[model samples]
Target chain A: MRKILLSIAVFGLMSVSAAAQADPGDFIEPIMPPQSINLGMVDLGKKLYFDPRLSKSGFISCNSCHNLSMGGTDNLPTSIGDKWNQGPINAPTVLNSSLNLAQFWDGRAADLKAQAGGPIANPGEMGFTHTLAIGVLESIPAYVREFKQVFGKDKIDIDQVTLAIAEFEKTLVTPNSRFDEYLLGKKDALSADEMAGYQLFEESGCVACHNGAAIGGNSFQKMGVVEPYKTKSSADGRVAVTGKDADRFNFKVPTLRNVEMTYPYFHDGAANTLPEAVDTMARVQLGKKFTREENTKIVAFLKTLTGDQPNFTLPILPPSSDTTPRPTPFSK
Target chain B: MRKILLSIAVFGLMSVSAAAQADPGDFIEPIMPPQSINLGMVDLGKKLYFDPRLSKSGFISCNSCHNLSMGGTDNLPTSIGDKWNQGPINAPTVLNSSLNLAQFWDGRAADLKAQAGGPIANPGEMGFTHTLAIGVLESIPAYVREFKQVFGKDKIDIDQVTLAIAEFEKTLVTPNSRFDEYLLGKKDALSADEMAGYQLFEESGCVACHNGAAIGGNSFQKMGVVEPYKTKSSADGRVAVTGKDADRFNFKVPTLRNVEMTYPYFHDGAANTLPEAVDTMARVQLGKKFTREENTKIVAFLKTLTGDQPNFTLPILPPSSDTTPRPTPFSK
Candidate 1:
């Protein structure tokens, strides 16, 4: 009976700890430092991020597909661009994009600068040639002047354009989440089911591949861990960028910061719910199956990733300056 | 000699005042409050905004289109959904959306709450049915408990969903644009060309149609004041929502806060550049023709409306809890 009492006491203590996990449905992150990463010259990038005049058609903006409101990603499985043509792969969220060592599903671009240059020239994305982009921007005296001041140039150029956009992207880091709070000894930060999910996540060896600052974006992993990914995907995954057969079906592990919001889940965007997706991960990737209850607990834990709403300042373009001599295109 | 000295003195005097009209781009406003919009509940709205798990097909999040990193608006003229299906209208920016009394192009929904509900249920937007939505959350026990605590229910419900999101939306305000600073007595906030544009904006009566906290969104105006909008729109302006002839060519005036970034400007996305759009506005609404010089100055002035960037805390989601119940239907 004394031993039974001790067991009950221990169970009660476990229950107390379990009661504290929040669903993260409230978007509460704790213990985050301000202005953590500053890759200088990013403010210039902020302007480029919002300047749609970079497009040849002058209609499309970079924010068209990858957005911040829904977890740095658009809701579509395949992104739609300038002419409403379908993009090859799912649009990844721009949030925390700076954290990646390489970018895009195939990891074609090395950094944000290289990544910024890709879409503007892509046949389907911005559908604009560099010369055409310069022509449109040069038509407006305001752009011509800002371009020279920003890039030390005589005309609107692509290097400055992409660099400015990349600088802005580097600043797009997500703040503290409920999980962070829980880790900081706010023991009540996670609840019983979320705690169970965490235990499951660890025991299931998800941490083997998904651990670290970005949770998953640190490296690439094969889609089907034990088996091959059984789903149909449009883009050939990592092989498109690296051109290696071994890299086929291997894609960069995306960050789970706002994973709950950045759904259609996976490269092809086939998963529907966190629970269902979690269940699939267990079955296919780990080769360890999750029970219905286990899946529910894991889903409960995944929902805690929502961070606080950010305050975004809408950028306003100024009228052209007269004192500042607007540069004209020189004879080539 | 006295007259020349007097002119110089007048110019010098203008330098000291905050609302300098020394140049078209130099006009400023008085000090206003910071972005004091309470984001407490709106934090929840932001989570809802980004979480694609809410969709039936699980493809899109509100941020998928209305991105903050690239201005509040998305780059696409019309967004594509789940199966590469097309969206009817251009995605409007969430920036200053709270200031708009009515929501959407047609003013179909009067408040953000009503507006939030429509998109979730829209087959093309989120494609979520209420029953299945609840099921998605219920499957996660931690979310189930959140539904119970926040809404006092045991199931995922629509009322709770929209309210939490609406609460989040209220916090999404654009504050302290350079214009706001100029308005608030920051004498040097704007450049000379921008001052000239501000003067033209006031003198041209553009203020009559585009004024208030959002600079426009408070009301609706006919697409063609000077000429009927010179474009074809599959999303028939506002006629589809009201079924009235008067509303045919009428659409909600979008906030010009970040107009430069939300390119392919206008309801059907007819104009490409801010200058081009401004020229169209001048000719059609005011029936006034602008010289290239004037358009340049006005565009510069518009750039002064950009405000400061807010600090955001990105949260990491932890595990879930067992006692937490799924949100119920209409619990709000």
Candidate 2:
């Protein structure tokens, strides 16, 4: 009887160890830096990203809205576009966006490549046509040479441009956050309050929608599940893409990786502070309100999501040739 | 008689060599890179230079008009400023601006430090007061820490801000141009046509006002020394500073270093191409006309002034805190 009991106890211990391997935080995963990337494509893409010549005004670049310096966001309520036109929705943070299942708030574009082309031609954004943008690149001999080398194509096209930009975007993942370390089996990474906040976050069912490697980007959730969110913004989220009333106010869950830096949260950017955003999510998404102390602790836990940012040299753009088209920023 | 002839020949050769030492092209001096800069102040200034938060709109930065990527100048006819406001005068290149005797086309500000503060308060430019700009920096703990480290000051002010920016600008000097190599004793650096162009430039007295290490930033010259220059631009130039009739239309001669990149020349930015600018300067400034071939040669010679641009990694700015004053980009 003693020998039989020892065998059963050993088997149970083995089963517990196996379960621990798969249940490392169960709902959360640590972000890892990209291992392999084409340096030539990334270099070309970086130049294109910072090149304001892509815009009709020659003033705005990809960095204008998704500024890498300031947590991959413009930090505005909404982005200011070409000719100072105000955008309808808040510009999403570009940091760790590669982990997202789909790009943009509405998940309209399939991936970063498809999403890259949207803003360049958007009437309210860059306000430039693909043909005009290509013409600008074609006029510059240096850009032509680089495109030929990177894409191995004689003809420069929008496909190649977006491809290069997407490749560069893939490298923008932020890793080594305190929360990520904790998930990776470092128990001492988080403070007592932060650990308590994590427990509350998991128990409150916030993990249902906000889960996976990005902590939120894997799913589409309704903005106001329990209560209708009131805002001045007219954006109908996924309804514009799905052509269905059921998808109204449904938006892609934003990644919480750099949530501390990406403030004025949500589709309309109604919540100016993390506390306000946290309180709103609790009341509206989960229909559960926590005390001020709990809210403060949760915010403290969120602050641990701030990670190392992408570091790169500012690219020096080639000069425009005599034949290059001039930007008519003032002309209609 | 043979001994005296030999002595005379030796004396002539020695005099010619001594003259050549003084004259190394006689008028223009090669620009040398700045040595021994404060790296801490420069790093801080680089962030300030690129930070759009300095502007009320949070859209325009010092880089917006004086773009380092595109030859330290926007290459625009005139600058598009806050709220897309059109600037009256052409924005000058910040490259090698430290070598200039004074700052601005009208020499309104004594140096770069003084010039740095002008655009921030200009109603049509950055459109932010010094106090408000200071508030933006003071509110961010990272900037505050950096300021304290660099300046050893508990309280930050506009003076230190401008000083830091000026220090960064001082390091923007572009050295090692082909022409600079020629000046530095590499005689074969210039082609035959380029040499001819240089000779023509000197013979035409174009070097009279444009003589210095910066090639043109040594003195103030009238825009049209020989004839009235026609322009729709209402900028009265140095008259704004001197408040004298003689100073009307008298502007600072801009540095010709990297002139190939800094295009759309003159205060009004009416001359679109280098050839056009050359022809206009010859006609109005020097009372002479050059043939198309000569103009092309001069343009080729001018291209040799293109130098090694400033290379540096893009700075990662710190996130704004909850108490930090938010940018009012859209609010009037």
Candidate 3:
């Protein structure tokens, strides 16, 4: 009888310990750094990402709009594309984008690899066809050799280029944010005001849409759930992708991992400051209003989401060979 | 007499050794890597060099034209500047530019520091005045802090900005070329044909002006020294700086250290291939023509001048605060 009682006591203690370990608010997960990466593919992808020769103008690369230096964004209201063409929408930050359920404002591309090919061929962006981009790569002997080594293929293709670029981008996740530390059992990671703001963030229904490892990229949500959002931008949002009227104004939630670095928020880039964006979201998305102090505290808490930026050596591109095609930047 | 005879023998051997060491083609010096650099200034300058906010368009940085990935040059015939404006002359390579007697083809700016400021304020270049550039820098707290730490000044100025940029550029020397190896007593570094080409180069008097660590940046010479060369470029060359009719076609001789990489040779960038550039230089500068075989050999020798490229980590710029002035990229 005593042995049976002791076994029951031990099982009770084990259950409590397990519950405690799993219940760290249970809403958000800490973003951990990638465990491993293929170094060769990452190196090759990095070169391709910075190589502007992929564009028709030879001035726009993948890094042009999704600049890694500026929190994986251009920090412009909209991107400047080929021949200085104005981009249709605000460029989404590439940092932590791999965490997203789908890529782009409308969730058009299913993954980062698919998204990689869009900007290169888009008439409003890089302004180059897949065939031309492939031709440029095949002409460069160094790129051909690298492609052969990385993919173990004799012929280069657009699929391999995008795949390599996506591999590099997958390593661009920003980990070790203060919020992440707080979630990982660091009690003093947040100040009193920040903690209070987080409490308000959860209680006021902000957690409903923003609950995930990326804090928001786990699902699609309506921009204006409780009210209409007014903007001059002609973007139809998810309606264009889904071909359904029910999906109008619906877009994939962007990751809030490095929101402080990515300013001019929302699909139209209508809000220029954190306070302004918070106020707008509270009013339109939740039909709730916050005081000045509340807004300031929330903004302070959001700042803690900024994580360690990716550090990497600048790539030294191989010189173009004699037979390599020269870039015609000004010649349409 | 025995002691005096021993001294004479020692001195004779020492003299022979000294001659052998010093007379390794004394006309040209080997470019050595910088021994010391100010890390703080280099870090600050690298961020500033890549920052497009200094430009009115917010789309162009120093790297736009002097791209380190492509032999410190844009590899374009002429640079595409503010609002896609065509630059008057081809952008020069920044590698080993510290060895040049002066900066720019006309030697308008005496040094890199002065050259650094010209582009920012030039109407046709970055399209931003010094005052506006300073304002942009001052508005950013991170930049202001960095400037203070680097220069020990409370107020950030254009002078300090230029100084930091120049300090970073000073470290962009490419060293340890195959030619430098041969000069340093490595006999097998050069092929038989390359050695023959070097001999012909000396005999043809091409070394008259092209004799320095940078090969050709030691002096200014007339473009058509022996024969008038034709070009569609309207640049008046050094006449703009000297205000002399005699200096009409005189321009600073460009560095030939990385001639293989900095192709589309000359101020106008007319020659697309190394052989074509060699043919033109031999015909117009030296009044000597080389056979196809000789040209090929010389081209092979020139290829040996490509040195180890600069390798450094890419800078991660600080995020702009709310009070910081936003860039007006398309507000011209």
Candidate 4:
């Protein structure tokens, strides 16, 4: 319990640090990252991600929730899945998942691979146990051979599925956000308002937990620093994972890669709009409310985080079933 | 009705004529048919085709079968599904699907777009319905915005989905096959055995129907033109769609593009190894027996049809759903 208190106190200092930066006008506009991209596995991963028929329901796909058009989410406060059952929390955008060291609000998953394997088995999600999932792939002689080629024979199991996906996600780095450009030394990357917002973000101290490559995700913090968050028992946040008193209200700091589009923020999805989220974060986490100008600037800065959507081809499904209705889309 | 019948007759004639082009010394290869590839549509369609999340089940992704890695197919006699249901037919490679005017052996879909929309709703395959399928994307704000941006506002419908996928499919072409090179004055492109096989293919009268840029997709014919197809109840073939007495034994001529890899051939998926499939097609379709030398040469030439796979990336699922158990190898 004492250690938990210390952890909370450390988190508080981190938030305060963001506001105390020397410039007090620190903004993170992602520019094209300096590194060359490793696209080999990523290319394979993208194809796999969009191709359905991988799920047992033949209908429950990854794009069912983290849709590219809808700010990376399906816009539901909580995601629904195979059974149309509710996911525990809001489905998060995949925009910058790579930047997060420990994933999920409770920091339960260590990386993207760990996260990729979760939903396919969850009762409300893809809903297949690993055994069932492997059986599905194994039964397909095509997959059996392909697995041998890509991951080596017997390597086509769940680990390769997760690893391949994780390797692919690493390529999905949103390198050149306008904010990133500015952060990487581009003076004209941001407009005046966005620059001002960046300043305010630093001055207001949001940079504390929401910094690093993803602008957040580096740490965890209590939802309500100024006021004890009163949002009704709220999904239990981190307590469900840790089962400790001080861990309550702590959630993973999400990447701000595409924050402008991934709205309805917070673990409970309480904020439906970006400005509202910023305002709430300012008031609750910062222990200080910002004027409209500051909030406006920060929101403007956030807009630059959205990245380019790559063009991809959808693979046509194979025809092999014995009988299918005209409307039955699964058969060839 | 008359036009349809006339066209069908002409198509049949085309198939027969191709079979009669059997010159003992000529190399039989797919002639590069000329047509303008809509570069724009190809760009869009390629993106859609690679996207697997369009289906209800994320796991039964298109690449799971018609993959570039394993000769454009998963090499299975049948495919697996969301609930681990083993599909009845082998997955076809998408390597050159653009050539086929009619899709699937049953010819259920008229175009690639129609084919694109078919699999997502197949109960035994993708198992997603139109409503749920659309809802899946509509829920994703990012996809919604993209549909609006790429196709147009509020155009996140199935039409757009199919069109985009079709556009992508058109680009999945085989370029500069050795046969193509040989035809274009590069005589050295063919090895002595390949030349022998090519000569036999032409002499075997394989080119009359299988001629054109995407050889063989231009027409449909009875499966057992010379030797009766024994599997009358096989995988519904093309009779399921047209339901005509004359169409009972008929099916679309598949593109021989990369046919070496898209194995376990025939509508009923009776063949296992490529050698077996090729040899059987000779006996059943051509009414001729191939000597060991001839068959080996033919198989060798067929391997040249394989194309290189394209590069892509995978998306990272958000970590909020971290129930991901440590993945074991995906065992067959």
Candidate 5:
């Protein structure tokens, strides 16, 4: 009877341990292959991503603002746009952006495809109409051929272009971060300081909003929950999308992956360094002040979030034909 | 005695044919490897080439003007620069530019490295001083580390930066064109019309200036050798370098390789299409007005020069640090 009781107690402990081990909701998941990844569409999207011909100036491509090179952001406080116009808000990093609950700082778009269409037609951005962009692609024999292969259509459309671009973007996820390695049973993957930062991050309430496969991208949060954040930019954040006064200053939390490379943080890009950004976030969002040593540890941990960047051969764009419209860079 | 004489005759005939076949100097040679190419330096150079952080606006890079995807030219009549300023002269294709007798249309800069420096400081171009650019590089840890490794020095300099970039450009040659294949004894490499065009190109004295490894970059010829070409821009061509009135219209003969892709031809970027360019070149330089058929054939032959482009991964640039100067896209 004592031996049987011991067995039952052992089984109960095993069940509890297993449940604790399997609970992955609090940690950001490592990037993996999505269910629907069309290679043909991705390939086509890559060409479009790099092709500057889509702009009215025949210069700016999707890669111009959302540069795949520098953690998918231009690293500028704000982007330089058509006619060298200054963008009102910081350009968000496009790396792992498909994982976001919605697109843009204000969550203006529902998905990556919807977000792709916004920049092409923005007079301050690419400065080209969707009609003209489609016409430009239609004129190119290579683009037309690839579009037909990918979309099963005789004519290239804006929807097809956006869809292809979004498909490519969905593949741009940085996986195998040191934190992820630690989560995946590698205890020594992170240093003592980084582990401490991770602990502090969870205990300090960062995980409350930042928990998901892409940490911080899965939800919307007010920028200054405690102390009001100051910025010169006039962007109204989620108020633009939600059309409610209560949604003011609420923005989609950006992914922390590769945050080290995506500098000049926040929607306004007011924080110039990681240390400053961490300090501000601690004070404003969590209503807690971190010690200097604690801030340094968190910043160091943030750097470890950087993962392997997207690696691919530069696409050799097909030469423009006689019929193709020439890019007018000097003209409005 | 009869057999001996027959053998002697056959030997003489073979020697004559061999001499004709071996006279490759008069024609452009196929691109071959240079004596030295440091992989590390090339890697650094590529990152620098694609990095817009070099610009004051953080929007322009070497690739912004000399795009590798589009035949190493921006496909612009004149390049757009800082503040959306228009460049006076056409941006030359950087592909096979090392083969040129000197860099730039006027041969103002003696080499590629020297040419690289001008654009960075040019108010109309990148609009950033070398000091500022070097300062920016020093602030970035990744750039600093790479520069130290490549240059064997603790301090980064503009010379090292240009050297690394030039080393990369040395590899940007487009080889293995149909014309090159034909030169290598591929009998049917080109179509009959293209063959006719090649024959006409050789016969019309076009090959006189457009010869050697780059098929044009070897010499500076008067833009209007026979008849004065009109242009609105006040660029004095080689006179800017030579300081002599006699050298007024002399400009570097751009490579015929990938001419099909590098459109809007001439120092002025006057001709928008290949057929128009061929006609203009024949009229202004050779003083020979060709029939419509002749012009078409010449254009067709030019298309045969498109070769294997530089195939490599798009470089991912390092992010800027806090100490790095923020790009003043609106200010300067």
Candidate 6:
């Protein structure tokens, strides 16, 4: 009975320490549940998300890049665009993307709605104009009826399409990770090694840039803070958006949720594994060399951040009408 | 009470007619539910179906061409493949494809498993070899575990992968179309025009090749039997597979189930609309020209083939492990 009381006392102290460590506005927080959803708009968005008819090839959709089945990323070093064109940067995960301060690697688009339009009109991406995309939707009788019901308008527009897609995207938050459970007073949720790794992560100052409900995506940070990040690709990062030479290698911090699934990490997707990524960050960002064991511990902690993935039925799109223009996939 | 008795008499007569039409070894029947599924194999296959890692680029999957969301087809005249290489023929719908006597436009593959292997290795398709694919699977711990559990094997193999994919494909049958309800004695399921079209369809020789629970896919037939098919493409159809002059211009009859959505019809995908395809098939295959009204009625009946699509949660695939080969999508 005395031994049992002693163990209980020790456990109570550990729980108090964890609670004390949970400082408000720290580097992490639980993912909030999605706010009010418009099921009609969401339904329309689901169809649009899967409808590749929006592209010139009629073969690529929002799901092609931000695939829900694969951690909202194509899992390629970079994306394959229209006619197998290689995109400039690594495609970021769209999971919990709404929590980001801005959208895209360079923070070019302000929100998911604005970011949604870039791919459809990009010459190397979906390779179609908003007018052509709208025209395709306009020709589909079922789509027209759906758009009418969702937008309260007789006609379809890119704004309505993007808005609906954004609405759906907002609901893709990943909550209830092991870390979140630990934060919510579940002391045994994480293993001792994982807890140790979390402490090292905090002590090493990695949380300065990666802290938030998203674990990142709240601000822009220089890729090579302490050293240069070498790559053959000549992307100017945020410089293209800001026209500032000083901002040459700065990029919006990508969310770490489901980081285990979103492989080939960073702007260039240079780091292929979580351990490699951690070692690289330690060397380049913190300017510190970690022992092999420390790297493993950090990776273990990172794995606990993987939350539940989004679950939804694959939406079935309506068939094109007689008036719908045929896709010219092979044409120049 | 007298009106109810008269209606009952009429309904009883209609039931008798439907029962009499259900002949043994008939050209068509209502689609049956999927026969005994090994759900574990299906679950693994579902992940593989959405896994782009099967491709050399890691951007294309079985779902890329045979998209479940869009009438089981990519809706392209021909699929855009590796490095943007255009495929020679239109992709066939995978929906209800297991019913076919053989797979592919030329009937080259014996079954779905054989067909699934072709695209992964095809230079213009997924652009990967079975050896490399197996190596990748072997490196992934989760996939290795799954393969062991499903196949009762110690190591991952290409055969097990294909078997699992085929097992999943078997469950893709679309049942309960409006036409099936009509066939099941719900006489009012189809509109008057649709019924008239069905009558014309049976009276004409369209039922000869385009029949069965799949509404086709029973055997190989000449693309243009009574008349020669015109095309800019030089593909020799089944001749390439059989190495016979007699098989020239011969191709497998594709399913007319969901024919309304599988647009750009034929092996060449020359017809862009159902009405246009009806007119062309009438002129070429049956060697009979139909009036505008007759063509409209036939198209209307074809619309009733759109049935309940496969409904399930979008599967989340296991992440690639450290030893897994990184996809060199931009390289040759």
DockQ for every prediction shown: 0.07, 0.57, 0.52, 0.06, 0.63, 0.69
Question: lDDT per model, in order?
Answer: 0.63, 0.84, 0.83, 0.61, 0.83, 0.84
The digit string of per-residue lDDT tens for model 2 on B1-332 reads 22212322333332323433346555578888788799899989999998888989777789889988888988888998888889998999999999888999999899999999999989799999999999999998999999999999999999999999999998999989999999999999999999877767655656566657888886777888787899999999899999999889989988888988998899998987899999999998877899999998888888888898988888888777788788787889
The residue-level lDDT of candidate 6 at A8 comes to 24
Cα lDDT tens digits, model 6, B1-332, are: 22212322332332323423544125468888898999999999999988888989988899999998888898888888888888999999999999998999999999999999999999899999999999888888888899999989998888898999999999999899999888888889999999888877766657666777888887677777777889977778889998999789888989999898788899988889999899999888777899999999989999998888989898988888988998777798
Candidate 6: stretches off by over 4 Å: A1-25, B1-25
Looking at model 1, give its docking quality level.
Answer: incorrect
Model 5 agreement with the true structure over A1-332: per-residue lDDT tens digits: 22212322332332323323434433557776566899999989999988888898988888888888889998888988888878989999898898998999998999999999998999998999999998888888888899999989999999999999999999898888887777777879989999778767666656556657778787667888877888898999899888999789888888888999898899988888998998998888767899999988888888878887898888888888778888888775
True contacts kept of 5: 0.81
RMSD of 5: 8.3
Candidate 3 lDDT over residue span A34-118, tens digit each: 7578889999999999998888877788988888888898888888888778888889999988889899999999999999999
Please provide TM-scores, in order, for all candidate models, with all chains considered together. Answer: 0.59, 0.91, 0.91, 0.65, 0.92, 0.93
Model 3 chain A weakest 10-residue run by lDDT: A1-10
Runs of candidate 5 exceeding 4 Å displacement = A1-25, B1-25
Name the candidate that leads on DockQ: 6
DockQ, Cα level, model 5:
0.63
Q: Please state the error at residue A123 of candidate 4 in Å.
A: 10
Instruction: Give the alpha carbon lDDT tens digit for every residue of A245-305 in model 6.
Output: 9778889878988999888899888789999999988887778887999888988999998
Chain B alone: TM-score in each candidate?
0.82, 0.92, 0.92, 0.80, 0.92, 0.92
Candidate 2's error at A47, in angstroms?
A: 1.2
TM-score of chain A of each: 0.80, 0.92, 0.92, 0.84, 0.92, 0.92
Ranking by DockQ: 6, 5, 2, 3, 1, 4
The predictions' CA RMSDs to the true structure, in order, are 12.0, 7.9, 8.8, 8.8, 8.3, 8.3
Tens digit of per-residue lDDT, candidate 5, span B139-172: 9999999999999999999999999999999989
